[model samples]
Target: MRYVKWTFYTLIALTVFAFLHYVLPQHDIVRITNTDTRRIDFGENSIFWASPDAGTGAAQATRDVKFIETIQQNGRPMVYRNEDTGWIWPPYFKFNSYNLQTEASDLRSTSADPRWVVVTHYGWRNEFFTIFPNAVAVRLAEGPNERIIPWTNIVILTLLAVAGIMLRRMWRQFRERTLDPLFGTAEEVWEDAGDRAGAARRGARTSWGRFKAWLRSLGS
Candidate 1:
């Protein structure tokens, strides 16, 4: 049972980590290589995609998605899908895919005159699933190796930690005020019953001793 409890807690922690990693904005310093639009048919990997642009109404099973291609500082290739998250999950509220694509195209440069930009995005680039990270914003970087501090992530995680601590404290107070008293009362009742049973047994033994004394007197 102890091992099972630990395993359950480990799984829950991993799940929360994965969820935050996917939802939180991440920064990548890269040089824009190309910007293009591709028609994608929603399937098993559709969940990785974002909702339609604001005021675009419901999303269809098939649609065109804008993509920004880039080469990272380490020379590794990365692709980001430019789409509006609308009012859906992750709450980026981005509705400017066209503008972002235009900006990416303008920032395209060659190796000799590389225009490095920081791409703020979420999700993972999985080649196996052909899912690309959704780009939320893009801005010019000072250099290819610009130091980007994720202050947003730090603040959000801190708030979450505080919330968890508060919740645990509330639960402890509830147990002490509500549940603990009930259990304690039940224990007192059980102890009292035991004491009464013991006293009854003692009374019975004393009565038996007196009856035996009367029998001995008669025999004498």
Candidate 2:
């Protein structure tokens, strides 16, 4: 049971970690190599994609998704989709897909004379599943080796930690003031009942011994 409880807790922690990792904005310093748009058909991977452009209805199961292709500082290829979140979950509130695409296209560079930029995005790039991270914003970087501090992530995580601590403290206080006292009272009652039962058994045994002695005296 203890192992099972720990396993359950570990699973919950991993799930939360995965959720935050996918939803939170991440920074990547890369050189924009190309920008293009592709028509994608919705399938099982549709949930990974955002909704239609802002103020537009869902017209069809397929739409043109803009993409920004880049080369990382390590020379590996990376691709990101540009789309409007449009009042959806994760709440990036991004309605500037076209603008971002233009910016990315403007920042496009070649390997010989690369212009590094920081791409703020969320989601994972999986080739087997054909899923790409959605780029939220882009900005010029100082250099290829720019040390970007994830201040947003740090602030969000700190607030979450503080909230968790506060919740735990509240639960402990509730248990101490309410549940613990109720259970403590019940436990005391149970111990008192056990003591009374033991005493009654001892009294009955003494009376039986006295009756046997009286019977033996009368027989003699």
Instruction: Name the top lDDT candidate.
Output: 2
How does each model score on TM-score?
A: 0.85, 0.87
User: Where does the lowest 10-residue lDDT sum fall in candidate 2?
Assistant: 51-60
TM-score of 1: 0.85
Any runs in candidate 1 off by more than 4 Å, and if so which? Answer: 190-220
lDDT of each prediction vs. the true structure? 0.93, 0.95
Q: Which pairs of residues collide in candidate 1?
A: none
Q: Candidate 2 versus the native: TM-score? A: 0.87
Clashes of each: 0, 0
Taking the tens digit of each residue's C-alpha lDDT, what string does model 1 give over 1-220? 9999999999999999999999999999999999999988999998899987667768899988899999988889999999999878989888888899898898899989889999999999999999999998999999877899999999999999999999999999999999999999999999999999999999999999999999999999
After the best TM-score superposition of candidate 1, give how far the Cα of residue 62 lies from its true spot, in angstroms. Answer: 0.7
